[model samples]
Target: MIFRLSPKSRRNLSRIIPYGVIWLFLGWFILTLEFLATGNENQRPETEITLSFGVLVFASLAVFIAGLLMGVLEVFVFKNLFRSKGLGAKIALKMGIYLLFMLILNALTFPLAASLELGTTLTDEKVWEKFWRYLGSVTFWSTLISLSFHILLSLIYSGFSDHLGHGVLLNLFTGRYHRPLGESRIFMFLDMQSSTSLAEKLGHQRYFDFLSSYYNELSDAIVEHEGSVYQYIGDEIVITWETEKGLRNGQCVACFFAMRKQLESKARYFQEVYGVIPAFRAGLHCGQVTTGEIGALKKEIFFTGDVLNVTSRIQKLCKIYGKELITTQVLKDQLPQAMADQAQSLGDLELEGRAEKIELFSLA
Candidate 1:
């Protein structure tokens, strides 16, 4: 028998596994320190050593379990609970909620740890007595403090990972783009149709809210297609993908349609809330780009090449040609044959500021 997870599940698991390891190490570190302090190395009895070893094993297992539960709650349960709230409010709310959750977990684990030490059943009176006593002990407070500190660290990491895409953060930490490298990438320049008119109709604040909602809906499709958001400029979003990933099964093309379908599925919600269903246009092109990190105060992974310029020009032509989506022949040729066959040629069109005219295609 075999088991498999969807892309989203795999991403969630990647986040979850780290919490377990962090908590496990914290627990082991605390136990080992106490173990060393409580006894002499040459004079410890055999039974004491055995009991201490049992306590260490059981306590480590307990914290590891607690860590896994915390991961699930953080990833699936508490995520987005106060997504629209300010940072301070979100942090305060999560701290209160997680504090209570951690307390409950600690309470439950206490009796099991006591049972392992005493070699008694969890239901024994001694276990409950020990649990109550442990609650007030310095060790209990220390553990709580340690857990809080770790939680804060995790929150900071999550914030960074969210603001900068996870892939971008990993690359920055690993120094993968410290030196510039040229690579073939697919770029999609997507923009809302009639954004100026929509902004005028909705007003500034309302329009900002609308854009947030719009991007939130499209993000799922982009992630599913393994696209990284390059930038968000006003009502437009730029997405990029490695050539292999984008061309695989025509995922770059599929992502565009998927985003449209996602918005359409929420048509009633958008119409009821904002009095309009947003429409978008996109232009995609693939070619080599110089990729590297740049900046001192604010570092950013940037892609620089003529391909980006060409892609942007093609997207601008969407309004001129009155088309929903357009792509260059250079990219279309690399797509799956079935997808390529679906594209209707739009002839060689001259792009602004470029010497050569490039043949384009429109996906119906």
Candidate 2:
């Protein structure tokens, strides 16, 4: 059977591959060794016989196929069903999906091992008795295995995402940045507006909660616009993307506006919950930056150059210039015509600690 995956689904599928590879190899080794160690290979448990093989080629294929199927199905669940639901609801949904998929797998593989004999050429009473026993065993083991796998996978993905952010883990591990490299990238510095006053109004703990919810609200827009979160510093977030990805559909610009719209829509909700509405100021610029992995104790893929400096300065100018979003002419020049036309001149402006004046623009 052929299954087509959407881009988002493909991304989710890619995340579990490393774990799946290790699981496949480990399962094959343990099962083969255990069967051989039994000393009576002819006599096997039904499930054991199904996965065992006389030839290494067949054994490898069986292990690979089982691993591939389970991995794909579980990832599908993660991508489609695992939304930002409540904990109780998510767990119940996952258990249901696991039980259903496991039964489907058992149906397909039992016959492949020619172990479907339990129901064939047998009296109805005998077949029903065997069927109940088979169902009971499969249900017990499938639940146990699925729960363990889900827990392990969650931990792996969480730890990976927390430290590395999204979409850069494999690249780092593959030595994609062994040496300093130069590449053109779009950078945005998003900072919460009136942060000092807001902090005073809400105090420390409440202010931290506000920042958390504020960033959480922007997470969807970032992913939807296909942007990578470079870093989070205090109350500000830094986002970056390779030139092509950022400019492909003008995500670099559109993302900022999308975030504004999202917050606007949630304005009433925020007011009711936090007793305050949050606003943001952002700056955009594009240029070449030196990129490489930095630090030994706390290793990081770092980007360094004037591009970041310029972007940060522009963000600071938002309040000074009385604009919510600010961008340099350098970035506007690279945007597509449709997006470029949205920019109207804000005139040349001098940035702090910089000798050269920059031509700036604000989007309509």
Candidate 3:
């Protein structure tokens, strides 16, 4: 079987790699400046530059390794603690912790590197003296300043990425959608059933809290199925996937059931929290769309296509058809054999605004 990274893992790697590259370049640039500032009187500039480049490779590699480790800690460990905190709190806490980690790493690594250069054991008196001397030097403080800048950048990027979906941040930087482009995509429009009544029953504030919990609970299944959350409009969430990704192992269809299962698993919690278990209906459709960047004040990647409207129409029909999940035949035909076999055809149906009739399926 071919190995593939889940969407979350790929997103984490995209976040982690930039830090290493930044450190590699920054380390080389700083070391070159140091050589130019404190070169031997007899040594030529070119010769000094060449020697500095040669020695800096090892140091740069060490810095890169440190960056990667720190990235892992920030992405996997610290991220969990950041969920409830505000931006200022997150930055301050990360800076303090990262500064301590960097100090500890530098303290141990400097001694090890020195011991290797002098060909002596770590317990040697010379290594201890050198390490203690370095603590008071300007270089040590400068290193801390560099690390502080790196941590701040990482935190800022992390916050932005979280706010604007991970893939969106990368695309914005790369300018992938600067020009309008046509592509095939699968979209799923999911909305809470009887949301108006539920809101009236629970009141505005309690309904908002219930909606938050509902979306949070279903997020795992969406991620696992490689779905990108496009938008959340009121009680409706629009999810999208690339054509190939959604078809793989019938993920588009499977995602619906997985989300249903997740909610069912959390039935008790929902019942206790809101005195009701939230239920949802979804419609899946796939087609071509023109994608491009839009908005001057607050930019976003916008998708313009009939498929979005058609998907919404299909979702609205779920109540009339009395089905939990409904999908277009165009999507059902492309699903895996096992998944496709479970589809119960609803025959040709007329959409609200379109003259053309469409074949729909309800997944069992």
- Candidate 3 ranges beyond 4 A from true positions: 1-8, 32-55, 116-121
- How far residue 63's Cα lies from its native spot in candidate 2, in Å, is 7.6
Residue 307 deviation, candidate 1, in Å? 2.2
lDDT of 1: 0.84
Residue 254 of candidate 3: its Cα lDDT? 86
Q: Per-residue lDDT of 195-274 in model 2, one digit per residue for the tens? A: 88889988898888888789888978887777888899988999998988898878899999999999999999889888
Each candidate's number of clashing pairs is: 0, 0, 0
Error of 1 at 345 (Å): 1.0
Q: Which runs in model 1 stand beyond 4 Å of their true positions? A: 25-57
* lDDT, residue 167, candidate 1: 79
lDDT of model 2, residue 291? 92
Which ranges of candidate 2 are over 4 A from the true structure? Answer: 1-10, 16-47, 50-154
At residue 60, candidate 2 shows an lDDT of: 52
In candidate 3, residue 194 scores what lDDT?
Answer: 88
lDDT of each: 0.84, 0.72, 0.84
